[model samples]
Target chain A: MASNDLLKGMLKPIILKLLLENGKMYGYEITQLVKEISGGEIELTFGALYPILHKLEVEGIVKTESEVINNRNRIYYSITQKGNSKAKEKIAEFEEMVKTLKVFFKPNFGLKYEFIG
Target chain B: MNSLDSKHIRLIEADVENARITINNLSQELVDHICCEVENLMSSGKSFEEAYTIIKEQAGIKVLQQIQENTLYLIDKKYKTMKSTMKITGNVSLALIAIGTALKIFHYPGASIALLLGFVTLCFVFFPAAIYLNYTYKKDQKKPMLNLSILIGGIAFMIGVLFKLMHWPGASLLLFVGWSIILGIFLPILLFFKLKEAETGKERSIYVLGVIGLITFEVSTMFKVFHWPGAGPLMILGGVLLIAVFLPLFASMKFKKGTFTMPQFIFLITTSMYAVVLTFLLAMNVSDVVMDRFVRDEANSTKIANYFKNKKTVAANDSTIKVSTELAERTDNIAKLIFDTKIYLITNVEGVSESVAMKYVSDPDLINNKSNYDIINHLLEGENNAGLINSLKKELNEFKDKAISVSTDPALTKSIQELLNTSDKQMGIGGATWEELNFRNTMIISAMAQLSEIEKNVRLVATIVK
Candidate 1:
């Protein structure tokens, strides 16, 4: 599991990307999907996820729909057209960041290959 | 795949409720998430209770609350900041008002500064923030715009009242605009919507009656601020509606439903409300009684009128009143100056028309008469007259021993100077409102007494030509 501070910065793009791909998802479903996809490496806490999702909703990047399932109301959030473009831009920027950071960890570095990006 | 049973889902719902997740959407989301996590754990061969416990332990209750807090913060940073700022300013304004009232009561200085700061902060910071937050928060709820306007009108009306109390410029305009919005738009819409949502016709009518009372009261207050007609009648009508009509309706409702857990609680509330209404009535009566008695006992009105008439008669007898020198000429202007000062006190401070106030002096023709003891008598009965007296004293100090050495009585001038000094201490600390009435009355009386004493030692210092 990633530390909360590190995960906090990463969660926004991760959520936008998830909604972009999944069409629509509720709070728990998104957390479960992340756990499954990351093979338990990135366990998204409800504490961390909901706020970003809510912020996204407030920004008009995502909109919610309430549906009754198993006699319980589930609020599902879907990415808007704005969110789709935003997600793409964020992913590209993150990749660029990673590529630049990767250059600093060239062979013959102090750290082992296992910890390298 | 494992899914929670109805019983387990119900338990999750109860847990969300226990967490005080009052926001419907957020609470629903929490329950779903908790159920999903419990089910996933249960699929791993744990019992239902064990699975729930394990998931609960993993995601602490504190974490659940943190999510709610973070969501609130994230949705609007300005809302959070404004909310806190509003609270701070609201408290500060209230404190300042309390302290200001106390200062005025004790006849201390800085009362106006405190009051001005309080009102300005309330109007600029607190009201704006409250209006913004109420609008944004209620946007998702019913009648968001109406709620916004209601808050704006209510707050604007309160600000106008403060402005009036401070006797600030544009008080009339502000009050007019505020009352128009509240009475013409907000009140009607509020009544219509509240009645529309009424559970029973009786309840509907009761609330309507209450609303009518409130509207009448507000209208009367607005009228009172502007010094318009029918203010007293309208105010009484509003008071009757609230106390006689609304209170009884409320009691009947409470009794019919048996909603009161403690009988004494309802009784106490009703009694307290009655006390408040009675207090208002008593206060108004007391103010009138005090003002009448004070003015009559002092007889400043009669004295001032007599003095004005005597001056007029004396001036008529001698077309060109002779004085010894230039100093005597300057000294002669003092009487007219005091008369002008009296006129200013009557028109501005008392908020009475110049013509009407002139009637208070028995002689209409003496309105432009030269100053005398009677003129000072009436002039000193005003709160702002203290300021005029102080300025006059200052001007006298500049003239002391320079051009008029023999004409003025030293002992009388010194006493007048002392009185003016004491009056200056009471300056800007009292106003004409019910709350400040006692302080203001005392200040005016003290100044009047001093002016009367000064009037006794009449000195027309005729300068001896070299």
Candidate 2:
């Protein structure tokens, strides 16, 4: 689990990852899925989801379709072909970050103390 | 799960519209999201009202506006910079214009410089940046013509104000056209869009009233600019409609709905203050004191010239008589040439016939556009600088040499040379010839007064020769 503050810069990749897993998703569905995946450790706000989705659509990484369902308009976002490579790249970058950060969690505490002394 | 009736959907729609979401399609997305949230909550045994209350707390106006801001910020790379530039330039130009107007009202120096800089920056930088930012914020709204009209009309109005303050020509044309566009093009289109999006009859009435008031106010402003009759009644009527009728209604409606924001309040106050300032600027009149002074100076020089003209030369010897006669002829030639030049300047500046110019030359206040230097530039400094004024300058200098050669007193010769010298005078700046110094940008009355002064000098030297 990670602090929600850590989710700020990584929201795009998380959203892309979710879009890759599910071929298409609405804004509320993505929020619910992120909360479920992180086991409530990361809570996406009720208002913060659409900007990233809209930006992804603007960058041509995703596309949107608006449909009338149950007497209301619902927008669904789906990843484009361009988003596939971007998703893989972002996942690899996240993996690299996790791998580099793992060193701090390893048993190197006593080694650093000995080297400083 | 509870499904919403059409009535409930309309409630959601009104709530979204109440947010006044400016971004394209944002209200739709937010309304749909809230509907889904409410339906989900209702399935958990909550009533429709309870679910909707919870949803309303989450999707407030501030939150919706924040989402729109974030989306625009993410999509536009230059948004932050453009916004900052618009703010800085708007404030800077406003300050400059305020200071310039204060200085001009007090007749202090540097007012023109400040006004010029303020207008240039406002028209060129601040206006374009503001319009660009506004257009980008609502890029998908399909109202490009609204922005386009505002850009053109706003720029034209600003430049017209500047030119009017500077006493430049074509100000009336620009002011008229700018206001016409705003009245005819901008207001009509804005009213159409507002009417289309209006939810209540009250809102539609307010929008219509506002447009009618603006049209009346703009037309009255044009009438005031041209000083046409009935401008006063029209101005008062328009002001009453806007200040007394439209503004309070609009404010109360917004405040009652809790949609009034801090920026809107600030904008209203500033706009009222701006309109008052504009009214004062329109009422301002150019001072005639400088023109009166030139007229007085010309009259004094004329009196001195007549005294010199009537003075009889007392010649004790025959040689002295010949020298004095020749000197008088030369002085009269120079003086007549100066008078002809004045007549020529008047005819060319006013684009009138020679006879009318000759009649009007003695009273130069009758000539409009007194500061137009195009005729002077053409006659005195033409493309090659060897204009007709060069010949006049040469003849005057020759007169100076002739008087000097005839005089035996060294002091007298020295005074004559100094009095009639027409060589290039380096005033404050550099490299302007004598003709450029005198005639360039000089008012016609002042130019005529200047010729009068020159004629007096030539006469003074002639008396010395006698």
Candidate 3:
């Protein structure tokens, strides 16, 4: 399981990427998909997730539309044009950060891996 | 897999309400989220109550509230910026007003600029910012309409009051709108809601009576500011309701509910404040010393006005217009100067018009030893009247200098010198006993006699000059 502190910084980019692919999603569906895809390893608390979603909405990266579904008012969030462009930029940044983390964490055995290859 | 029915969904919604989600949109979103989570759990073969318990235990009440808190934080960033700006500007403006008022009192520099900056910031920046912040906060709390009305009315009333206090423009319209909205709409709606929200008849009566007291107090102040009638009665009634009825009722309610600990302290503090205000009002209304001054001031003003009116009449009569020669003209001018000086005394001492002043001077009963002797004596003798006397002395000195240069007549010069001497003698009336009120009246009478003599001599000098 990923630590919450570690997951906190990556949650926005991850959600943006999910929206980029899924086209549209409500809060419960997004939470369920994240749990499913991560195989229950990365559980996002609604407490932590809602704020990030709201911040994105405030930044105009996402827009919401409410509909009554099964006698319930469900609000669905979709990526805007601004959100699409921002998602691409954020995904690229996240990939680069991951690469940097990989280099720092990989066991070197006292030699650079590229030189060994 | 089993799914919860509509009644079970309502239970979930009630739980969300219990979580204290005040924002309407946020509450709806939260309800939907919780419903989906619980339904998913129920579909996995747990019963409705079992699924609900599992979901609630996993989320925890604190975390459920945190979601709402985070949303609020995100939205509040925009509001917080304005709120801080309003607070800063309000504080700065208040400081400037305080400094400016102090400087103005002491006759120092930078007073006007400071006052203008303070007033402008308070009226424009701080007040608008406050209105915006108040509007946004209230909007989220399910009373957007009431909030907007209060914000507009409160801001308008405050700005109008500021303008009226500073004697600026556009106070009338602002005041009219502000009073109408606040008194007519906002307060009634607020009281209606307050009464509606109360669970019991006791609570309802308490809210209604409390609001009546507060409204009566506000109306009393409004009446006083506009100089309308019923200020006194309204004030007394408000004070009685607040101190006698509202405070005790409020305290008793709190006691019944076991919510009396911290609230008891608040009640005591509020009661103390009300007591202080009531005492001050009583002192202002009932103190004989204060009322005596007011009555004396009014009477003196009327007498001064009468005195000046009679003088105008006497002067307009054809018999008194005999400035036919240069010497007589000079004498007439001198007499006019003496009368002008006397006018200064009457106006400054009695604060009355010319006709009223003539009546005061002629009415022997008014300046007699037994009646109003203390007042007349104090006006002539006390430090209160010294400012007028000092200014009079300066005017007389300037006249002397100019008359000496213009007139070669020793008689006119001597008359001017004698008038100056009588002014000095009047100044010496300070330490005299209250029993010497008769002596004080005699001094004023003799001064008038000297003035008449000066006028007669000026007429006699007309033949000499011709």
Measured by TM-score, the strongest candidate is 2
Model 3 chain B weakest lDDT span, ten residues long: B364-373
What lDDT tens digits, residue by residue, belong to model 2 across residues B206-262? 999988988888787788666575665677677778878988898888888767776
Please state the interface RMSD for every predicted structure, separated by commas.
1.1, 1.2, 1.6
lDDT tens digits by residue: candidate 3, B1-466: 3455789878777667656666546777777888888888878878877888888776654566677766777766876578678889999999999997776544467766788788778878887787675566543366666677777787788777666644456875787788778877887888888887787998999999988887787677666555576676787787788778888888888667533456545869687676748654543543333345457446544544443333222222233233222334455556666666555455444445787656655542232111223334444444854533344344445544543343344554454344333232233556533224212543343334434543443343233212
Q: Is the docking of candidate 1 incorrect, acceptable, medium or high quality?
A: medium
Q: Global lDDT for candidate 1?
A: 0.64
- Write down the DockQ of candidate 3: 0.42
- Model 3 residue B300 CA deviation in Å: 14
| Residue A71 Cα positional deviation in candidate 1, in Å, after optimal superposition | 4.5
| All candidates in order of TM-score, best leading | 2, 3, 1
lDDT of 2 by residue, A2-98 (tens): 6667878778888888888899888888888988998987777756788888788888888888888889888888888887788778878987887
Tens-digit per-residue lDDT, B1-466, candidate 1: 6877788899778666645554448878988888888878888899998988888776555566667767877887876798799899999999998897677544467877888888778878887777776666533256765766767676777777676655566766777888888888887887888788666989898888988988888787766545566676787788788887887786677556433335545675678587647645643653454456577546544443443333322221121233334445555555455555545654543344777656633332222221122333444444664556555554444433432233234443343333222223343665343213312333232333333333332232222222
- How does chain B of model 3 score on TM-score? 0.51
Give me the candidate number with maximum DockQ. Answer: 1
What is candidate 3's lDDT per residue for A32-87, written digit by digit as tens?
88999999998877777787888888899999889988777888889999778887
Better of 1 and 3 by lDDT: 3
- Between candidates 1 and 3, the DockQ winner: 1
